[model samples]
Target chain A: MKAIIVDDERLARTELQRLLAPFKDIQVVDEAVNADDAIEKISKHQPDLIFLDIQMPGKTGFDLLEELDNVPYVIFTTAYDEYALKAFEVNALDYLLKPIEPARLESAVNRVLEKSKKEDTPELKSGKLKADDQVFVKDGERCWFVKLEDVRLLESEGNYVRLFFHDHKPLILRTLNYLDERLDPKTFFRANRKHIINLKWVENIEPWLNGGLLVKLKGGQKVEISRRQSIKFKDILSL
Target chain B: MIFSVTSVVVFTTRLLTAQDFSVGMIFANMVNISTVILLWSAIYFFIHYFENLKRSEIERLVWEAAVKDFELKTLKSQLNPHFMFNAMNSIRALIEENPERAKTALTQLSNIFRYSLRIERTETVPLEDEVKTVEDYLALEKIRYEERLNYNVEIDPAVKSIEIPPMMIQTLVENGIKHGISKYPKGGELRLKAVSVNGHAEIVISNTGSFSEEEMKNSKGFGLDNTKQRLNLLYGSKSEFNIVNDNGFVNVILKIPPGGRQNESYNS
Candidate 1:
């Protein structure tokens, strides 16, 4: 993972860079001292991650995030205690306390790697799509501003995902596995290898062939949850 | 041989050699006058003592209330300085880590400082306002703690209009981070939920970590005892505060009763 350490303190920046040198997974791309400098470097390097300090000369770490068109995976580096970070941690960001411990930094970087590995899509900062999340979908000639809750089903076809909503089925270039990464599991279920269905749209469920379960959606679309997934379905939704 | 009305009493007593008819009548009149004087004096003193006792009772009640206000204010004073001190440390770290991030934290730090300065030493502020301040605080801390911390906040629509003590919830959260999450190598989450129950606003904060009996007794961890004191001062028995550790997680729940406070407009 390519990363940058942005802090006003020269010693802290140098110290952290030295500590991070031992970690082989992450490459320290370039360092930026202030928000303006960091912004310029970020746009230039487009580093996959940033080790950010909250307090700086001009703009704060948060202010830098606010100004960004796309935020990288952020692991905060500051002297403040964990209590103060509660609000922003709501976003899928992490932080490392000061006098950065090598082990802690290693674990935090490993988490970023684990997440990227799980998504296989490094561009989407961090976090799952909620019910009313707005996502842009362009299918050849037509485009969409589909609300996540409005879509009832997602079916996989090799590298593409077919979004099935009311009277419209738009195929998007994103992989079904990618959709699985962004969708909340409790609401969006991975029913089978080729399909993930919205639980809210399920009209009925009955026994299917080969001991699987057939789920009838509100729009008359029937999906088969593979036997392996049926067990998970029951576990998640209760018997 | 003749003794007239009042003079008859004195004359009869002096000339007691022979039995006199006027002697008994004069003695009776004198006894009645003296008895009236004694009764009046007794009633006057009794009333004076009772009035003095009543005044002291009232004075004692007022003094007790004033002391409570003072104690609550004292606790409030303690909260901000502690919060400020941590914020300063955060800013200091930012100064070392990234001047840009420190600059960012500086703005938030100052805003909080201004808010604290302007805040009316109120027992409670608008819930929305309190949440905003908490957000700013967390943002600064987010920069400081980085990846070790994670948190979640859920607010009920009904509780948005309610009010709560300025730093009450924040203090508990701070304590949670200080004594619990900060101590752990891999820091954990802090979750805050605000909901309305039976017309009262209930705020529940849970953070990942537990407290030893020693820690709770020695430090009160900047949470338990002062919180209990503040609640009593502001809500008496109408409000409730509880802190419990279930294994590794610590939960602090506060409930504010309805109808105790008059409606105040929500601060933006």
Candidate 2:
């Protein structure tokens, strides 16, 4: 598996690389000094896993994750930040403290391998996000790795878009038009100017005034399809 | 019962001395003995009560000193594990790059840990000793921060023997690094100067960063507040602590009076 190490300290990066030398299955692709550097490298290499340091010079590891659209499997590395450690505990995520022990590193790497094996999906080369693609969303102190299939609706509010999935409606720094372009048109339908509905989650559809369609989602959210989009939706559904 | 014994003794004495059976003289002698015995008892009890009060007062003072010592120890223990782990990480890397420097770095780390542990047993340490520890601390941090951290220490020999609270200078210097130097992306310089000013050891630690009101409110109070309480406890109002943002630098000044060893006698 391709992996990247992100830490501001050169010595810390060197130490982590030395420890990972024993694990032949995991290859260190590149190193990033801070959050911005990590973001740039992550997009360039598209590593499968990252050993992230929570504290850096500019932005923290969490800030880097929040900025990513497709977040890889992450194993956090921190010195002694109790607040960051608490977040890991709540999320049940893997983390290694500094002066990392060999046994703990081995276990963390093994867990990453096991998780990747369970999710052995092919990467989409078409540049469009598929139903299997997972996006990272962080709201305040809470974070989630939400799959596109699970998202039933997305509503636009100014420059941000709010995603509805599993009783969560956390807003992300994305626009509806941008998501509509990136998402696969076969699954996600642009219901109106303000809403995008997942076709798989359409529970009830009824004709509304002015020939528009009213759609109810499985998650009990009501979305109105514009008259022009409703005709296209019926054609796509063949009804 | 004691009253009766006194009365019998007094009556026998009166009878023997008078050589006659006189009830009035015997009763008068018994009354006089009773009054003398009461006066003696009052004096004895008063002395005993006064001694007990004095002992309890001493005990209370000792207890208060113990609590203050414990507080100081706890404050010292908050030596920032973040620094510990980061230092170890640096040493691990140095092992491959420069082994000799790595060994020296290891020694420095141990020195800091040892000093922190030993400081709990004493309230104040000589300026020379504390300065050595702080130098070791800065050397290790220099390795971690590399070119980003630059520090200069100037100590006046006159104030080297003057005793100040253990880790007082070190703590302020650390604050300068944590809140000031480390905040900048390009990093900045730290200057520590210890001089004798008007019979008081005036130590000033200045770094290249701003100590704005917003950051002062946002930062955790454990380190700065702990330093304040410790200074107040050890030197009462004699010691002075002042922090301000001047130009582009944050300056922390500590004025410690000589012989600030209030808790030294408590060890016995």
Candidate 3:
């Protein structure tokens, strides 16, 4: 797995790199000094995993994750931030404290390896987000690593996009138009100007006013397909 | 019985001496004796009451001092875990890059830890010793922050021997880095200058950053608050502490009166 280490301190970055030397499967693709640098490096390499420090000069680890559309697996690295630790505990996210123990590092890497194995069945399709891909959503103090397949609906509110999955409805800073271009069209269909419905989650559909269609999701969410898209939806579904 | 006997003696004496003992004279003598007794009793009770009150007041003050001393010790001994872990990580990395410098860095880290532990033993330390500890601190931070953190210490020899509250200056300097330099992307400079002026030790710590009153009000300034409380407890209103922003630099000025307070329990 390609991994990048992000920390403001050169010593800390070098130390992490030294520790990961024994892991043959995990390749250290690059190192970033801060959040902006990490963002740039992440886009360039598209690494499968990242060893992210929670504190930096400009932006924090959470801020970096919030910016990404499809977040890679993150194993947070913090010195001893009590607030960040509480967030990680609440989310059950993996993290390694600084001066990391080799035994702990081994376990964290192994956990990520096992998770990647379960998701290996999905083929990477033309650089677009797949159903098995994970996206990080943080709301207030609560954060979750949600899979694309689990999200039943994406509703637009102003410039933010609210994702509906299970019982959570987290608003991410993204536009519905921007998400529509990135999301796999075969799985997520743009229902209207403000709503995007996951095709696999469709439960029942009924004809509605103005030749639009009212579709019910398995999770009981109702979405109205626009009159213009209903014909396209029917053609796609019937075929 | 004494009164009756005295009256009988007076009556006999008057009869034997063949003198006219009037009722007015007897009444005047009785009044004089009662007045003397009342005066004696009133003085005795007042003395005892005041002694008890004074003793209790002293005890209350002593108890308050003890509690404050315990709190100061706890506050002084609390080394920031964030700084400690980051320093350790930096030293660990240095071990492979330069063994000699890493050893020195390790020693610096140990010295800081030892200084904090020792601060619990005394309320105040010489300016010289505190400066040495601060140097060790900035040295380690310099390693962690590298070129991003720059610091200079200018201590006047006259004030080096003057004693100030332990960790007072160090805490301020740490704040300069945590809230000031660390917040900047390119980082900034930190300056610590100590001088004697008008029988008081004036220590000023300046860092490159803008202090926002709004942000400071929103977030509880833990280190700053603790330092203020500590200074108030140790020196009362005698010590001066002021923080201000001047031309994008945050300056924390602390003034300690000469011969800073000497409490037996705290000193020991």
DockQ of each: 0.01, 0.46, 0.58
- Candidate 1 off by > 4 Å: A1-239, B1-70, B77-86, B89-100, B212-214, B260-268
Q: Tell me the TM-score of model 3.
A: 0.83
Which scores higher on TM-score, 2 or 3?
3
Best by DockQ: 3
Looking at model 3 chain A, which ten-residue stretch has the lowest summed lDDT?
Answer: A119-128
True lDDT of residue A81, candidate 1 = 45
Ranking by DockQ: 3, 2, 1
- Candidate 3 CAPRI-style tier: medium
The Cα local distance difference test for each model comes to 0.73, 0.85, 0.88
- Alpha-carbon error at A101 in model 3, in Å? 0.9
Q: How much is A20 displaced in model 2, in angstroms?
A: 1.9
Off by over 4 Å in 2: A121-125, B1-73, B261-268
Q: What is the TM-score ranking, best to worst?
A: 3, 2, 1
DockQ pick, better of 1 and 3: 3
Flag regions of model 3 displaced more than 4 Å: A121-125, B1-77, B262-268
lDDT (C-alpha) at residue A226 in model 1:
95
Q: Compose the digit string of candidate 1's lDDT tens values, residues B1-268.
A: 1124336545655565356647755765564465556567667878998998999999998898888767556676344454565556556645766789889888988876766765654557777777776677777666655666788888898888787777777777777666555555456778888999999999988888775677677764546777876677677778998878876788888998765444332221
